[model samples]
Target: MLSVRDLWRRHRRKVFISVGVLGSGYLLYKLYGAHRRRLDALERELAIQRESEELMKVQLSQIMQAHFENIQTISDVMTLPHAMHNLSCRVAEELDLSQLLERLLQGKGQPSTLTQSEKLNLWERLKILSFTRMALSVWATTMLSLYTKVQVNILGRHLYIDTARRFESSSTTESGDLVDKEDQQKFLGTVDFLCQHGMPPLISDMEAATQEALKGKQLSHFFNSTALHETIMQILIIFMSQGSPHSWIKYVMPEDSATSRIDDPAPSDVTEFEQLMTEARAVLLSAEFGSILEICMKVVVNAVVEQMGAKFRGGSIAMGLPLARVLPQVAQMCPLLLEEPSKNQFIRIIKCIPEVEPFFTRLYANMPSAY
Candidate 1:
């Protein structure tokens, strides 16, 4: 080493440079540590965001899956065969032909006051009435079943389309509101009409048709199987032809009960229900509905044919069966025809109707491909 002062002066520059280098190194270390901490924080934040995104994706998938299942269930349940079965059960309960026959047989008062011929005539009239009632019941039930099928089909198709549109747009709307509020009201209105008002006019028409078909005919002539079949067919034709689409709108959405709110301020406003009614009127006028009616007619005719044919083939007519035995047997068989095998046959016929098949095809085609 040199002398202390010389050494100090000579090395001062180097000392200063070394100290500056150390200070700069410490500052660089602090900056690197801060940047590293910031990067760690950023990575943690990104991980949380990714987890949140994945959770949302899972939840959305579940919701979409649920919506898909609901639509599938609706489609499965609203078929024509299912409708026939449901409506058949309802009609069976409502009409209760067996119970009706019993009541009719139990006269309002004792028959002690009436002469023997009067009793016979009354009995004959009761038989005709019962037969007519049975026929009318079948006709009304079938028509209503077809109508229910059509209504539900239309509703199902609408929902399918709506859900598809929503899915395509990535809508966050709840599936519960898929059916518009007004459309729901209109649907309920139709159910109300059918449950409350639809049957009465139909019953009245059936009664009128019965009277017209059997007017002036002798009781024996009326009770003959061939004659009864012809008469029933005629009555059905008359009943079917009685109402136009405009007239049916009254039945579908009755004027008295069309409004959802009793005191709705805008009574004349064209509500969604009114629009639905318009659509319903259009459906009623459509060729598909006409095809349905024709199919229903064929079903009734087929039932009558099978019943009459079976009776003849079984030699019930050839053996000179008593009217008492013959009539009850026929009446009992009428309801049975609506049971298993015949019901299945009718369903097949309905499914195959040329004009109606395309609707089913389109409805199924519109179903969503993804959940």
Candidate 2:
């Protein structure tokens, strides 16, 4: 009887302990629920604030754009001194160009003066952006100066080339790949932005502004100069990256042809690249851009090669020539480059390249078409 009573008491004690633990857990769960609800509420509020901030940014941009437009309309066509005075008044009235450009690009009210960190960040972005993005940005900047009747200067051109060189230097991988995965995404994003927000504006509105500005400044031949030529070459480097298998260029200049033997069977990637060239050529031919592209190409294929020969003095004479393809390959890709005297001249130049000539000679030996 004593043993039975002891067992019963122990069982009763155990039951009380179980109940106590369950009660504590229940209270803790209720407290957790209350805290979770508060956290969720805070997150919702934060999201709402972000949306409001973006809305305000959009509104501010619209207002500033109109303000600049008005300044341009009122100031342009005025005599140089009068124009200068009007711009000065606008500046004094709190419409500084740098500050306005800051608002345009960053949604900030600060001046366009860049901190070292900001410049480093901008340089990082330059590695991935296409020439189109760079060009559009340049165009916007030029327009802003023009709108304010500011003088055209070498500062813009110098910065552009320096950035491009730095970008190109950093663009290549240790393994000789031109672009990596991260760069591809950035490049695609830049292209997307250019097509969506950039080109349309430049083609429609900014084009007129550019022409008027150049004409007004009596620099109508500005676009035809070495400034634009060098810019075009830098832009072409973006495409050159596509030609390499290990580079992101293959993806951008993707191959999209069916496989076969001799007819279209020049490797899948090569076929794809050739197709891209064909499509691009057709577009260039059909558009007004053709004339400019033609001029740029003439400058590039001829003068660029000569410049490279001068710059790189070591045993590898072609070291400076990044787009140094075999003459046969370039011709196959774009036959327009093979037109008569130019083609003959290009062949002569290729033959004279010390580092490249031996390989070209061997190629010519095996394939008559290489000649």
Candidate 3:
């Protein structure tokens, strides 16, 4: 070692270099530690986010599955077979053709402002009219029943989709009771409308059509199955065409005090309900629906014709006509009465709407096997 002053002057540069190196190393270590800590925090946050996403997925899946089950249950609840059986029974009771015929014959000579041939013709025409009216009643009932089933299926699916979407976006979980209460009320309202408003008016319309078609026709003219079929088909087509699809909304979703609230400005489901109604109207106007309606009309018309032919063949009535010729003509008229190009377009469009395809399948499956 040299003297103190001499040593300090010589080592000062080395000391300053060593100190600077140590300080820089310490800073680098601290910065590395901080980066590692930040990365760890980020990893933890990412794990939490992934867990949350998985939870959300499970919840959404559960919600959708529940909705699907609900839709199936709804379909079972609105069974068309049960409804049709009930309707047929009620109609048979209300329109007893045998009793009506007996009554008509009982008053045969009671006083008429017409000749004997005229009275006989009048009685025959009335008999035919009664049969036509009965057939129309059955047709109207079948149509309305089919409509109710379709409406319920479409609206029920719509309601489930809407509820699922809502539940997905919301943080709060769904309450089963609340959803059931709302859905039940809406569906019940549809039933009420069908019974109280829908069937009565539709039946009345069909009855009016029968009256208009057979107003002045004689019994022989009425027996011209080709002309009769064409006339009835035209009336049916006009009846179907007269109303806008929107006119059916009331029957599908009847208003009820239960669905409304006095405190709230508007129901949360109003917009969704309207959207569903729009979709339903679209389905109604779709070609698929038209094809179904056409098929149903054919079924009803054929059944009526078959029944009439059977009655005629069995000589259930005293008409003097030969059954062999009349029955052949009637059988020939059993083919579809109307065909329109627009119905094809509707069918094509309906096939593309996958969401509604299930409904169509269900409807077609539920139709009478003869169809």
Cα RMSD to native, each candidate? 11.4, 29.5, 9.6
**Candidate with the larger TM-score of 1 and 3:** 1
lDDT by residue (tens digit), candidate 3, 1-371: 56887988999899899999999999999999999999999999999989987887787667656765565455435433334444445444443455544555556645454567756765554544453444444344444544555655555555445555765577346555423545444543443444445555555555566656556655544244445455556556655554674343343344342343323424676643444344444555456666666666655555555555455554422243432234334332222111121232222333344544565566433421111
- TM-scores for all candidates: the values are 0.58, 0.24, 0.55
**Ranked candidates, highest TM-score first:** 1, 3, 2
Winning model by lDDT: 1
C-alpha lDDT (0 to 100) for residue 271 of candidate 1: 67
Candidate 1 per-residue C-alpha lDDT over 1-371 given as tens digits, one digit per residue, 9 for 90 to 100: 56888998989999999999999999999999999999999999999989976876676566555655554454334433344454456546554556545544564465565667766766666556555656665565455545554555555555555665665576756555666756654563364454455656655666677767666665444244555556668777766667664354454455554333323423567565554444444555566566666666666666655656576666454334444455665566555535533344544455455756665455334322110
The predicted structure with the larger TM-score, 1 or 2, is: 1
* Deviation of model 2 at 12, angstroms: 3.7
Judging by lDDT, tell me the better candidate of 1 and 3. Answer: 1
